[model samples]
Each structure stands twice: as structure tokens, then as C-alpha cells.
Target: MDRKGILAARVSVFIVSICFIAMGIMRNEHFVVFKKAVKICLECIGLG
Candidate 1:
């Protein structure tokens, strides 16, 4: 990948990780919306 592509990929992964972490916290706080979002993130990350 080119430098720009690598940077974009890194940014994407970082954003995804942040989303997952936020969802996890929301889940712990009893937010149903976050639970679904977390599931989607897991699938996207190939962990679901």
C-alpha cells in the first residue's frame, strides 16, 4: 500500500477500535443501542 493508503487503513482501524470500546462501555452502562452496534463491529472485525 502507498503511504496514504497505509495511513487511511490505520485511521480506519483506530476508529473501529474506538467504536468497539465505546460500545462495550455502553453495554456495561445498559445501553441497548450500543449492544447492537457492538455486534456489528464484531462482525466487521471478523470476530463475530
Candidate 2:
């Protein structure tokens, strides 16, 4: 795509990311998901 199209795509992605983060924070899902992710990582590394 052209410069304007690329800029628009990046802006939309940033906006969506921010909105998702805000919703996760408001609902406390971020921390819960983080905890689960860490657990999964540890298990994958054979340290769980």
C-alpha cells in the first residue's frame, strides 16, 4: 500500500490495542492471563 494507507493501518492497530488493554485492565483479565501465561511457560520449560 501507499504511505497514507500504511499510516491508517498502523493507527487502527494502535487504537485497537489500546482499547483491548483498557478492557482487560478494567475487568482484571490481564493479570489473570499473565499468571496463566507464566505457568504455561514454566511448564513448557520443565520448571513447573
Candidate 3:
């Protein structure tokens, strides 16, 4: 594709991803992910 077409595609994809992230945040999914990450880290270090 041409440069303009590529730019438009990139912008559209970015907007869609931002929307999904916002939706996840609204549902409190970020905290759940953070908790899981912390748990995994603790387990890896034998503290969980």
C-alpha cells in the first residue's frame, strides 16, 4: 500500500486498541491482571 493508506491503517488500529483498553479498565480488569502478575512473581521467588 501507499504511505497514506499505511498511515490510516495504523491510526485505525491504534484507536481500536485504545478503546479495548479503556473498556477493560472500566471493568476493573487491570487490577485483576496486576494481582495475577504479582502472584506469579511471588511464586517465582518462592514467597507465594
Best by lDDT: 3
lDDT for position 9 in model 3: 100
The lDDT for every candidate, in the order shown, is 0.81, 0.91, 0.93
lDDT of 2 by residue, 1-48 (tens): 999999999999999999999998999998998887876587678886
| Candidate 2 lowest-lDDT run of ten | 35-44
* TM-score of candidate 1 on Cα atoms, chains taken together: 0.55
lDDT (Cα, tens digit) per residue for candidate 3, span 1-48: 999999999999999999999999999999999987866587678887
Q: Give each model a TM-score.
A: 0.55, 0.69, 0.71
In candidate 1, stretches whose alpha carbon ends up further than 4 angstroms from where it belongs are 29-48
* Candidate 1 residue-wise lDDT, 1-48, digit = tens: 899999999999999999988888867854665566766577678886
Q: In model 2, where do residues sit more than 4 Å from their true spots?
A: 34-42
In model 3, the worst 10-residue window by lDDT is 36-45
Q: Compute the lDDT for candidate 1.
A: 0.81
Give lDDT: candidate 2, residue 25: 99
Candidate 3, 12: how far from true, in Å?
A: 0.3
